[model samples]
Target: MTSSVFITGATSGFGEACARRFAREGWSLIISGRREDRLQALAKELSSQTEVLPIVLDVRDRAAVTRAVDNLPAKFDKLTALINNAGLALGADPAQNCDLDDWDTMVDTNIKGLMYCTRLLLPRLIAQGRGASILNLGSVAGQWPYPGSHVYGATKAFVEQFSLSLRCDLQGTGVRVSNIEPGLCESEFSLVRFGGDQARYDKTYAGAEALQPEDIAETIWWMINQPAHININSLEIMPVSQAWAGFSVHRKE
Candidate 1:
C-alpha cells in the first residue's frame, strides 16, 4: 500500500513544498489550510502526481480539526505521518510593547493547534501497526531568544518540549516524533511577522542568504524515509549566513 501523509498549513511555504516533495515520491496527501482556494489549487496541481485531499482548516478550531480528521476518506484513513507545519510569528516589537492579541494568536495556533491535531491523529498512527512519524516545525527562536520573539519563542519552546515528551509516551509503539527546528528561513514568515508590510519583509531578508521552504521539506522527507528502527528525535538547521546573536549591554549615559 502506498503511504499517506497529512500536512497542516499547506497553502504555501514549507507545507506546500512538502506536499509537492512527498507527492513526487508517490505518497498520497491530505493537505489542510485556512485558504480554500490555495488548498484547492495545490491539490489540483499535485493530484496528477499522487492522490490529494484538500481540506479547509483553521487548526485553532478544535472541533473543526476533529471533524476533518475523523471523517477522512476510506482510502486516506491510514495515515503514515502527520506534519504539523501550520504556525507563524507575528510582530517584531519588544515583549513589553507587543500586542496582546498577537500573543494570543501565536499561542492558539502554535501550541493549541498542534495539540489538537496530534491528539486526534495519534490513535490512527499507532493502530497502523507499522512505523509512523510526526514531524513538527519548530524554530531556532525556540532555543535562542531575540528581543521581539517573546511569545513566538515561548510557543515554539513548548513544541520542542512537547515533541520530546511525545517521544517518551510513544516509546515501543514504533511511532516516531521529530521536531525540525530551522533558522533564518525565507518565506511568508517575515511578511506575516510584520503584518504584510512588503517593505519590512524585504528589509529583513535583504542581501542575506537564507534557507528556503524546499530545504526544510527535503529534511522532513529524509526524516520520514529513515528506517523504522532509527528514530531521529530532533534536527536543527540554519544557513551559513546566519548565526547566534551577540549579547547586548546597556551603557550608562
Candidate 2:
C-alpha cells in the first residue's frame, strides 16, 4: 500500500518543504492550509510527483479540522505519518508589552490546533501500525527563555510536554511520537511574527546563516523513516550561528 502523510500548514515554511520531500518519495499527500490558492497551487505542482489532496483549512478552527479529518477519502484514510506544523509566533514584544490577542492566537494555533489534529488522527495512525509517526514542530523558545518569547514560547512548551506525555500513553502502540525543536529558522514564519515587516524579516536573517525550511524537512524525513524499533523521543536543531545566550544581568544606575 502507498503511504500517506497528512501535513498541516502546507502553504509555506517547514510544512510545504515536508510535503515536497514526502511527495518526492511518492507518498500520497494530504496537505492542509488556510490559503486555498496556495494549497491548490501546491497540489497541482506536486500532482505530477504523487497523489495530492489539498485541504484549505485553518487548524485553529475545531469544527473545520473535524470535518476535514472525518471526511477523509478512502484512499487517504490510512495515514502513515502526521506532521502537525500549523503554528505561528506573533510579535517580539515582552509579555507586559505584548498584545493579548497575539497570545490567544498563539495558544489557539500552536497549542490547541496541534492538539486537535493529533487527537483526531491518532486512531488512523494507530491503525496504520508500527511505522506510523507523529512529528510536531516545536521551537527552541520552548526549551530556553528569551526576552520576547512570552506566550509563543509557552505554547511550544506545551507541545514538547504533550509529545513526551503522549508517547508514554502510547507505549503499547507502535506509533511513534517526536517533537522537533528548531532555532533561528528563516522563512515566512519570521514575516508573520514581525507582522509582515519585510525589512525586519530581512534583517533577522541577513547574516545569521539561519536554518531553512528544507533543513527542518530533511530532519523530519530522517525521523519518520527511522526503523520501527527505534523511536527518537525528541530532537533539537539549531544553526551554527545560533546558541544559548548565557545570561541577562541588569545594572541599576
Candidate 3:
C-alpha cells in the first residue's frame, strides 16, 4: 500500500525533511523546488532509498507550476498527499517601512502560489476521491501578530483561514486539509528574515532551542498516518523555548 506524496520547496527546510520522512515509509515522493541542481541531487539521493521524482519549479510562476504538474509522469500523477511548503519571509519590515518587493514576493508565493497549486490539484485529488491530504505550511505569526510581520503574517493568515474554508468545502469528500502552524524553526528562517544579511542572521538565534525542520516533518507524517477516520484540521507546533510572537528568549542561563 504505497502512497504518492508531492511536496513543493523540497530543496530545503521542512519540505526536504518531509521527503526523507515519507521516503523511509516506502511512499513514492514527487519533490519540487526552484533549484534544479538541489532537486536533482535530492532526487538522486532519495531514489536510492525509495521511489523519487524531482521537479524544478517556481511556485510563483503560474505557467511553470501548471507545466510542472502536467508534466508529471503518470506513475507520479496520482498523488495521495500534497504539501504546500514553498514560502519565505523576504524582510522583517513594518508596514509603514516595508519593502514593496518583499510585499510582492510574499503575496505572490505565499498566497497566490498556494492558491494556484491547490486549484490545479483539486480536480486530480477529487478524482481520486476516497483519501487525499493537503498540508499547508503556515506560521504562528498569523495568529499572534508581531512588529515587523506586516505582509508575512498576512500571507500566513490567508493560508490559515483558507485551509479552514477548504476543509469545509471538502466536507463529504474524504479529502483532508491541514493548516500546519509552526512557531520557531531554525532552518535559514532568520536569514530569510534579514534578506541575506549574515550579520543580522547571526543574532536571531543567540540562545534558544528552535524547532527544526525535521520536527515539523515528523508531525506532518503523524497527522497523515492517523486513523483514517480522523482529520487533523490544524496543528500548532512550537518549540518549548518559544512562548509567542510577542516574546522570545534569546539568552541561556
| Cα RMSD (angstroms) for every candidate in the order listed | 0.9, 0.7, 4.0
lDDT tens per residue, model 2, 95-128: 8998999999999999999999999999999888
Measured by TM-score, the strongest candidate is 2
* Poorly placed runs, candidate 3 (over 4 Å): 245-253
Off by over 4 Å in 2: none
Computed on alpha carbons, the lDDT of every model, listed in order, comes to: 0.92, 0.94, 0.87
As a whole number from 0 to 100, the lDDT of residue 27 in candidate 1 is: 94
Give the better candidate number (1 or 3) by TM-score.
Answer: 1
Candidate 3, residue 2: the lDDT equals: 71
Worst 10 residues of 2 by lDDT: 70-79
lDDT of each residue in 1-253, candidate 3, tens digit only = 5798889999999999999999998899889889899999999998987989888889999999898888877775556888999999977766888779888988999999999889888876775556788999999978888878888999999999999999899988788899999987888767877878887876676677888899999999998877666889888988888885347667988
- lDDT winner between 1 and 2, please give it: 2
Question: Lowest-scoring 10 consecutive residues by lDDT in candidate 1?
Answer: 123-132
- What is the Å distance of residue 76 in model 3 from its true position? 3.4
lDDT of 2 at 197: 100
Ranking by TM-score: 2, 1, 3
Which pairs of residues have clashing backbones in candidate 3? none
Q: lDDT score, residue 230, model 3?
A: 85
